[model samples]
Target chain A: MTANWAAVLGSCAIAYAIKLSGHLVPHRVLQRPLVRASAALFPVALLSALMAMQTLTTKGAIEVDARIPAMAAAALALRARWPFIAVVAVAAVVAAGVRALGWMS
Target chain B: MTTKPRSVIIRDAISIGIAVGAYAISFGALGTTSGLTVLQTQLLSLLLFSGASQFAVVSIVGAGGNPASAWASSALLGMRNGLYGLRLAPLLGASGWRKPFAAHLTIDESTAMALANDDPADSSHRGARTGFWATGLSVFVFWNTATLLGAVAGSHISDPRVFGLDAAIPAGFAALVAPRLTTSLTRGLALVCAVVAVAVTPSVRPGVPVLIAALIALTTAMKFGEPIPPTTEDVSS
Candidate 1:
C-alpha cells in the first residue's frame, strides 16, 4: 500500500483503539478531571485551528481569498440557526460568487 | 424520567441520521479533491467513521501536510469519540462481540440520545439502549450511503474551486465548532487558537501549526482547571 493508504489504516487503528479503550478501561479512570478536560477541549481548539488554517492560508502561506467571505457567510448562517447543510451551501455560494466576480480566488 | 415511544425514538434517530449524513457528501467531495480515491474515501467512512476526524485527515492532506501529520491530527480529533464511548459504556452495558460494535457506534448523537432517554431509577437501561442502537445504526447506514454517492459524483468534478467546494472546507469546520462554543470561555479559547494557528502557519509546516495551537489551548484549559461541560451534542459525527 501507498503512504496515504498506510496513514488511512493507521489512523483507523488508532481511532478504534481509543474507542475500544473507553469500553475496556474502567470508568473511574476515564472520569478523571484531566482526561475529561482533554477530551472536551481538544476538539474545540483543534477545530478552531483547522478552520483558521483552511481559511487564512493556501499551500502553507498566508493568502487572502474567497474563503474569507465564505467563512463569514457560514458564520452568519450558523448564528441564524440555519441547518448545517444550509450553512455549508451559503459558504459555497458566497465563495463561488466572489470568485466568479474576480474579487478573489 | 419518561421515555419516548420506540417509534418516536426511531423517527428522531433517522431524522438526525439524515441531517448528519447529508454532510458526508461534503466529506466525499473533499476527500476526492484531496487526492484520495473513492475506495479510500469510502474506507474512511466505514472505518474511521467519525466526521470531524475524517475531515481533519482530508484537510491536512489537501494542504500538503505529510502523512504522519495527517494521521496525528485525525487521531487527535477522534479522541472525542473515545470520550463518547466512555460516557456510553455504563449506559449501554454491552458485552462480548457487542462490546466492539457498541464502542464503534458511540458518537455525539448516540450518546446524547441515549442519555436523554436514560432514567436514574431504571437499572435495565432499555430506553437508553434503544436510543443508542437506533441512532447509531441510522447514522451508519445513511453516512456510508451518502459517502458513496458523493464520492462517485465528486470524481467527475475537475475543479473544486469553481464550485466553491474548496471554501466549503473552512465553512464546515466553523459549523462544527460553533455549536460547541456555548460558553464564553470556550469561545475565547477558539478565538485564541484561531489567531495562534494563523500566526504560526508561515513559520511552521502545514499541519504543525494546528498541533501547536491545540497544545496551547489544552495547556490553557488545564490552567483554568475546569472542564467545559459538553452539554450540547457537538453533532458532526
Candidate 2:
C-alpha cells in the first residue's frame, strides 16, 4: 500500500513537471513553428494510439467481437450528432444486449 | 476583460457535471472489477481523473504488475494533458493562485468544449474560463461520487463486460478523434498511428504501443508540415 501511494505521488509529480516545463520556458522560444507544430500534433497522436489500444485489444490478444456492434452504434450516434452520453449509452446497451442474448458470446 | 455571465458558467458546469458523472460510473465499476479496495477506487477517481491513465493503472494492478510499473504506464499515458496545459495557458492564465486549477481543468473534454464555441475571437477567454471550471469541478465531484457508489453497489451490478462498459474508452476516444479529422494529413496520420499501435500491441506493454504510435504520428506530422485547422465553432457573444 505504501508503495502504491508512492507510485501515485511520483506519477503526479512527473505529470506536474511536464506541465510546468512549458510555462517555465520563455513564450517566445515555444512559439517557434516547429515547436507549435509538434504540440499541435501531440493530442492527435496520443488519442489515436489510445483508441487503437482500446478498440483492438481483448484480454491481451487481438480479436474482434461485440466491438463491431458497438462501433456501428457509435457511427449512428456520430452521424446524428448525439451527445456523448447518449452515444456511449446506446453503444453499451446494444453491445450488452447482444452479449446477453448470446448473439455474440 | 468583460466578465462572463454567471448563468453561462453555471450552465456549463451543470452540463459538464452530467457528462463527467455518467462516465465516472464506468470508472468506478472498472475499479471494483479490478479488485481495488473502496478507498483505493475513490482515491484513484479523485486524484487521477484522466480516464486513460486510471484504466492503465487498474489494468496493471489487476494483472499483478508492481505499483511502480503501473504508475509509470499511467503517467506515460497522461503526458498528453501537459500538452493541453500549454495550449490553454494563454486563454486561462490568470494570477498565480488560479493557474493550478485552470491547468487541472484543461483536459480533453474541456478543451474541446472551449474550442467548439461559436465565437473563438471574442469569447475565447470566457469559453476557456467556463470550460476550465465546469470540467474541473464536474470531474472532481462526479468521479468521486460515482466511485463511491460503484464501490458500494458494484457487486449487485454483475457482468460489467456484458454491459459493454469496456466500450466506453473506445467511444470516448472516437469522439475526441473524429473532430480532428478535418484534414487529410491529420486523418492519414491518425490512421497510420492507430494501425501501427494495433499491430504492435501484442508484443509490448499496452501503454508502450500507444507511446510508440504517438512518436510515429508526431514524426509523420513533422515531416509532412501540415497546418492545424481553425476552431470548428466560435462561441463569441
Candidate 3:
C-alpha cells in the first residue's frame, strides 16, 4: 500500500485543530453550565457509540455473531468485578470458543 | 513538593504499562499491515501513541486514501486528548518538561484512572504526580515496545481480527467507561451516548460519530443538572 503523505498530514492537522479549538475557548466559557454538562456527558456518548460499532458490526454488515458471546462474557466478568484484563480475556475466550464449537459460525 | 508514595506511583505505572503494551501490539500490527515501514510504525506509536488516531491513519493509508485524508481522520480522533489535557492541567499544574510529557500521555485511560481518585482534600500534587508519571512512563515504554513487536511479527500473522483483536478498541473504551459509573446520570448518559453513536456511525466518519455522542451527553447532562463527581481516588491497588 502506498503511503499518502498529504493525507497523513491533513489528518494530523485536523486532529490538532479540534484540540486547539477546544483550548481556544476562553476559560470562563468552559465554566458555563452548558459546556460543563457536555463535558460530563461526552464520555458516555463516545464510549456507547464506540461499543455499539464494535459489537454490532460484522464486516461492514449488521449481524451479530461471536460478539454476542463476548458481550455475555464481559457481563459475567463485570458482575464478578474482575479486572479489565480478566474481562477482556473472558470475552475473547468465550467468543473464540463458541466459534470453535460451530455455535457462532 | 510532597511526593506520592513510590509504591502507589509504581502500581499505577504498571497498570498503564500493561494496557498500553497490549494496545500497542495492535497499532504496530495495523501499521505494518497497512504498509507502514517498521520505522514509520514505531515513530507513529512513539509520537502519536493514541490508538484510535493511529488506527485511523493506518486504515486510511491502507485503503489508499490520500495522506491528507489519513492525517485529517487521525487528527480528528486525537482531538479528545486535548480536552483531557485541559482538565488535567489544573490538577497536575505541571511545568517545564513535565508539561509536554503529561500532555502526550493524556489519553482516556490515564485520565479516568487519575481522576477516578477524587480527593480534593488530600494532596493534589501527589495525585497529579502519581497519575502523570504512571501513565506517561507506561504509555511511552509499553506502546513503543509493543509496536516494535507488532511490526516485526505483523506480516507473519494470518488474521489478527480472528481472535477478536478488533474488539480491543471497544474493550478499551469499555474499560475506560465501565469504571466511571458512579451515578445514575452518568450511567444513563453513557448508555444514550453509546446508542446514539452506534446509530450515527454508519452515516458519518468513525470518530465524528463519537464526538457527536459526546455532545449529546454533554447537553443532556446540562439539562438535567447532573453532578459530575471528581475522579475516584480510592480504588484498591
Candidate 4:
C-alpha cells in the first residue's frame, strides 16, 4: 500500500482538533445527557469492534487461527485479574505453541 | 486528602507509567509487522499516543485498506479523547502554550490516574493534578523508548507469525477491554458486537465491518440510558 501522507496528516489534525475543540466547547453542551452517555458507551463498542477486526481478519480472509485460543487464554487470565504483563505473556505463549503444532499456521 | 504519604502516590504513578510503557513495545512490533515503516510507527506512537486509534489505523492500512477509511476509523475511536479533554481542562489549569500540550497528554491511563487521586476528604485539593502530569509525562518517556526497542526487534524478525507476534495486538485489545465488562450489559453488548463484526468481516472491507458493528451501540443506547447494575434485572424487563 502506498504511504498516504494526506490521510496520516488529516487524521492527526482531526484528532488534535477534536481535543482542542472539546476544551472550547461550552460546559452546557457537555452537560447534556445524550453527550455524556454516548461518550461513555462509544469506547465500549469501538474497542470490541477492534478486537474482532484484529483477531478474525487475516490475509484478506476471515479465518480463526492461533489468535482465537490465545485470546481466550487472555480473557481467562484477565478474568482472574492477572497483571497486564502476565496476560500478554500467556497469550503469546499459547499462540506460538498453537502455531508450532502446525495446527493452522 | 486522606493523608496518604506523597511517596505512595509517587510509587503508584511510577508503576503505572512503567506498565503502559512496556505495553508500547508490542505496538511497535505490531506496527512494523503490519507494514508500517519504522519512522511511521514511531511517529504514530510519539504523536498520536492513543493506543486504540494507532492500532486501528495500522490494522486497516496493513490489511490493504485505504488510508481514508483507516483514518476515519482511527478518528472515531479517538473521539473519546475529546471527552477526556473536557474533564481535564480545569483540573490541569494549563493556559497559553501548555494548553495544547496538556490536551495531547489526556488519555485513558492519565485520566484514570488523575481521577483516582480525587480524595473526597479534600475536594478542593487532591493529587489529581500531580497524578495527571506525572503519569502522562512518564508514560511519554517510557513509551517512546520501548517503541524504539520493539520496532528494532520487529525489523529483525520477519514473518512475525514465527513468534506469534501476529496474535499480540488482538490479545492485547482483549486484555484491555476485559475489565470494562463489569456489567452484564456491557459484556453482552461487547459480545454481540464482536460476533457481528466477525460475521461481517469476510463480506466487507477490512475496517468497514467494525464500523458497521458500532451501529449496534446506537440501538443499545436508545433502549437504555445507562447500563443497569449486574445484579439487577434487564432495563427493559
Candidate 5:
C-alpha cells in the first residue's frame, strides 16, 4: 500500500520536473535541431514501446491472444481516423468478442 | 463579435476536450480493473493529468512490475510534456504561480490547439493563447470529472474480468499507440520491440521488458534521424 503511494507521488514529481525543467530551458537551446527533433519522436518511441509491451505479454510469455485481433481492429480504426474514444471502444469490443468466440484464453 | 476563425478555435477546443475527456472513462475503468483502487486511479488522473502515462503506470503496476520500474517508464512517457512546455512557455508568458499552473496544463491537446491556432498575422498571439487556455482548462475539468464518474462506475463491477476489461485495457493501449505507426520503419521497430520484450519477459520480471523495449525507440530514432510529428493526438490533421 505504501509502495503504491510512493510510486504515484514519485511519478507525479518526475512528470512535473520534466514540465518545469523544460520551462527553465532557454528558448535558443530548444531551437537547436537535434533537441527539437528528438522531442517530437520521443512519444513515438515510448508509445511504441508501450504498444509492444501491452500486446506481447500474456500468461508470463510472448503469446498471441485476443488482444492481437483487438489491437488490429484498433489500428484499422486509427487509420480510418476514428476518434480516440471510438478506437478504445472498438478495441474493447473486438477483444471481448474474440474471447466470447473462444479464440484465445 | 467572434470572427469565423475565432469561433472555429473555440468549437474545436470544446470538441477536442470532450473527445479527450470521454476517453478518460476507459482509463478509469481499466486502471481500476488492473488492481488500482478507485482513489488511486482518480489520483493518477488528477495529479499526473496525463492520460498515457497514468494508464501506463496503472498497467505496469497491475502487471506486477516493481514501483521503481513503473515510475521510470511512466517518466519516459511523460517526458514529451517537457518539450511541449518548452514550446509553449513563451506563448503563455506565464510567470510565478501562473507558470506552474500553465506547466501542469501543457499537454498534447493544449499544445496542439495552440499550434493549430498560430496566427502569423496576429502580432499578439491571441489565437494561440486562447487555444491553449481553453483546451487545457476544458480538458482538465472534463477529464477529471469523467475520471471520477468512470471510477465510480468501475467500482461497482464485482469482477473486472467478467466484462473482459482486463484484456480490454491492454487492447485499448494498443489502440492508442496504433496511429503513431504511420511509417514502415515505425511498424518494424514496434515489431522488433515486441519480439525482444516477449523473449525477455519469460526470463525476467514483468516490467523489465517494456524498459528494454524503450531502447528500440532510441535506436530507431537515432538511425532514422527524424522524429515524426505526433499523430496520436491530432487525428484530423
Candidate 6:
C-alpha cells in the first residue's frame, strides 16, 4: 500500500485502540472517588479547552481574530437566555461580520 | 437538575451536529487539496471520524511532511479520545456488540452532550445515552454527507469559514457547558483551565494543551474539590 494509505490505516487503528481502551476500564476503577470526581469535572475542562483552541488559537499559535468576538457574542446570547441554535447563529454572524470587514483574515 | 426532555437532548445534539457537520465541508475541501483522492478523504471521515486528528494528518501531508510524522501528530491528537473514553466508559456502560460502536462514536461533542444532559440525581444513564447516541448519529450522518459534498465540489464551494461556521463548534460547546458553571468551584476551575490551555497552546503540540488542561482540572478537583454529595445538590443555583 502507499504511504498515504498506510497513514490512514495506522491512524484508524490507533484512534480506535485509544477509544476502546477507555471502555475497557473496570467498573470498580471508574467508581473510585478521585476517578468519579475527575470524570465529573472532565467535561468542563475539555469543553473550555476546546473553546480556547477553537477561538483563541490558529494552527498551534495564539491569534486574535474574528472568532474572539464571535465567542463573546455567543456568551452574550447564552447570557440573554437565547436558545442553543440562536447562540451558535449569533456567533457565526458576528464572526462573518468581523471577517467581511477585512479586519481579521 | 431534572432530566432534560428527549426533545431537548435531540435539539442539542442536532444543533451540535449541524455545526460540526458544517465544519466537515471545509475538511473535505482541504482533504482533496492535500492530494488525497476524494475516496480516500471520505474513508478518513467514515473510519477515522475524529475531526482534529484527521485535519492534522491532512494538513501535515499537504505540507510535504512524511507519513511517520503525520501518523505521530495525528496519534498524539487522538489521545484525548482515550481520556474521553475513560470518562464515558462507565457512563455509557455498553456491552457485547454495542461496545465497539460506542467506542467509535466517542468524541468531544458526544461526550459533552451526554454529560451535560446527565441527571446528577440519578445514575440511570438514560438521558446520557440519548445524548450520546443522538449526537453521535446526527454528527456522523451530517459530517459524512457534508464531507462528500465538499470533496466532490472542491474549490467550487465557498469557504465555510467565510460564513463564520468555524465559530459554531466553540459556541455550541460553550452553550452546552454554560448551565453547569453555576458554582464558584466549577467556574473558577473552568476559567483557570481555559487560561492554562491558551497559555500552553503555542508551546505544545496541537492536542497537548487540552490534555494538559484536563490533567490540571482532574488533579485540582482531586486535591481540593469538595467530595461529591451523596444526594444531588442544587448546583444549578
Lowest summed lDDT window (length 10), candidate 6 chain B: B228-237
For model 1, the stretches where C-alpha displacement exceeds 4 angstroms are B231-237
lDDT of 6: 0.73
Q: How close is each model in CA RMSD to the real structure? A: 1.7, 4.4, 5.0, 4.5, 2.7, 6.9
Q: Tell me how far the alpha carbon of residue A21 in candidate 2 is from the true structure, in angstroms, after superposition.
A: 4.0
Error of 2 at B177 (Å): 2.4
- Please provide TM-scores computed only on chain A for all of the candidate models, following their numbering: 0.94, 0.76, 0.73, 0.81, 0.85, 0.70
Pitting candidate 3 against candidate 4, the one with the higher DockQ is 4
lDDT of 6 by residue, B100-191 (tens): 99999988778777777778677887888898889999999999999898778654535757878667657866875686576677788788
lDDT of 4 at B7: 71
DockQ-derived CAPRI band for the predicted complex in model 5: medium
Could you give candidate 2's per-residue lDDT for residues B1-237 as a string of tens digits? 344565776577666667667766766766666666667777776666666567666655543446766666565556556655666677665668887666555556666555443245664577556656665677677767876886666545566677786665567667656766777877887888888877887887645665676577558657865467323231111
Superposed Cα deviation of residue B216, candidate 2 (Å) = 1.2
Share of the reference A-B contacts seen in candidate 1? 0.75
What total of clashing residue pairs does each candidate reach? 0, 8, 29, 0, 0, 0
- The segments of candidate 6 whose C-alpha lies over 4 angstroms from its true place after superposition are A1-15, A18-25, A59-61, A80-86, A102-105, B1-45, B48-99, B102-161, B179-182, B202-206, B225-237
Higher-scoring candidate on TM-score, 1 or 6:
1
lDDT per residue for candidate 3 within B7-61, as digits (tens), equals 8766877876776577677667666766667777777776666666776566546
TM-score, candidate 6, first chain:
0.70
Q: If ranked by DockQ, best first, what sequence of candidates would result?
A: 1, 4, 5, 2, 6, 3
- Write candidate 4's Cα lDDT for A77-103 as tens digits: 887988666777788888999989988
DockQ of candidate 5? Answer: 0.53
- Candidate 2: pairs in clash: B117-B233, B117-B234, B117-B235, B118-B234, B118-B235, B119-B234, B119-B235, B119-B236
Residue pairs clashing in model 4 are none
Model 1 iRMS (Å) reads: 1.3
Candidate 5 lDDT, tens digit per residue, B1-237?
222276787888888778788989888887777777889888888889987788888877777777898788888788778778887877777788888888888788888888777776666778888888888898998898888888888878877654666656766666666666777877777677666776777898877777776666666666666656544355325
| Residue-level lDDT tens digits of model 2 in A1-105 | 665565556655655565555444466665666555655565566667666667767655687877768868986897797765677677778778888888885
Q: Quality of candidate 2's docking, in CAPRI categories? A: acceptable
Put down candidate 5 lDDT per residue, A14-81, tens digits, no spaces. Answer: 88887787777877765555555455555555566666667767646677777787778877887787
| Superposed model 4: Cα runs more than 4 Å off | A1-7, B2-7, B119-126, B228-237
